[model samples]
Target: MDTNHNKSEKSFKIPGDWKEQSKQLKEKFSTLTDHDLKFEAGKEKEMLERIGNRLRKNREEVLNIIKEINLS
Candidate 1:
């Protein structure tokens, strides 16, 4: 007789105060939209890249926060 088993475990717990993080993200999006409206047509590419960088940083911040809270 032979027996074998494979198992994997993953964490699926929801982080604390996710609603506040969602609200802050929405506010940041609104602010980015407002900031984008001030740029000239000729600078669209540069402005977009800047905004994208800011958003990427914001996303990373949120992810880090979630990880800290959930993994602790």
Candidate 2:
């Protein structure tokens, strides 16, 4: 039932403290605007997809970068 797309749509739990995370992302990639990183309820995947497209990266790579943001 298109589980992969569904999965990608549901993946990535946006951080509660997203501003700091967004800041980190901006530092790493200056092209991202607040609108790109804006975390809306149930729209985490949309944001990720937009980021991946903007960065010319795949969702998995974008996901990895997002995951790494919290590590530092």
Candidate 3:
């Protein structure tokens, strides 16, 4: 009788609402001035990836803010 459990079996999922919110935020910031310079040196791809990372961080920060304000 094998009753062992695998830790890897546990998986976490981001809420759909949060995912949509993050997508919207990423799109919004993608057009901001900070992302515009990325195209000046022929680094559009790099700029996009950097903006993506920043957007992810922003999403996390927003989530934290909502939590702090007891809105989530």
Q: What is the C-alpha RMSD of each candidate to the true structure, in Å?
A: 14.8, 2.6, 12.1
Instruction: Give the C-alpha lDDT of model 2.
Output: 0.82
Candidate 1 residue 40 Cα shift, in angstroms, is 0.7
Using Cα atoms with residue i matched to residue i, what is each candidate's TM-score against the true structure? 0.30, 0.80, 0.27
Q: Which residue runs does candidate 2 get wrong by more than 4 Å?
A: 1-10
The true-versus-predicted C-alpha distance at residue 51 of model 3, in Å, is 0.7
Report every candidate's CA lDDT: 0.46, 0.82, 0.42
Residue 54's lDDT within candidate 1 is 54
Lowest lDDT sum, 10 consecutive residues, model 3, at 6-15
Q: Over the stretch 1-72, how does candidate 2's per-residue lDDT look in tens digits?
A: 555656534457875478898899999999988888888888777888888888889888988897899888
List pairs with backbone clashes in candidate 1: none
Name the candidate, 2 or 3, with the larger lDDT value: 2
Position 63, candidate 2: lDDT? 81
**Model 1: worst 10 consecutive residues (lDDT sum):** 4-13
TM-score of 3: 0.27
Cα lDDT tens digits, model 1, 30-61, are 64554532344455445444555656654335
Residue pairs in steric clash, candidate 3? none
Query: Residue 7 deviation, candidate 1, in Å?
Result: 49
Clashing pairs in 2: none
Residues 1-72 of candidate 3 have per-residue lDDT tens digits of: 657543443232333454444445445555434342233344434544454465554434644433443332
Q: Distance (Å) between predicted and true CA of 54, model 1?
A: 0.9
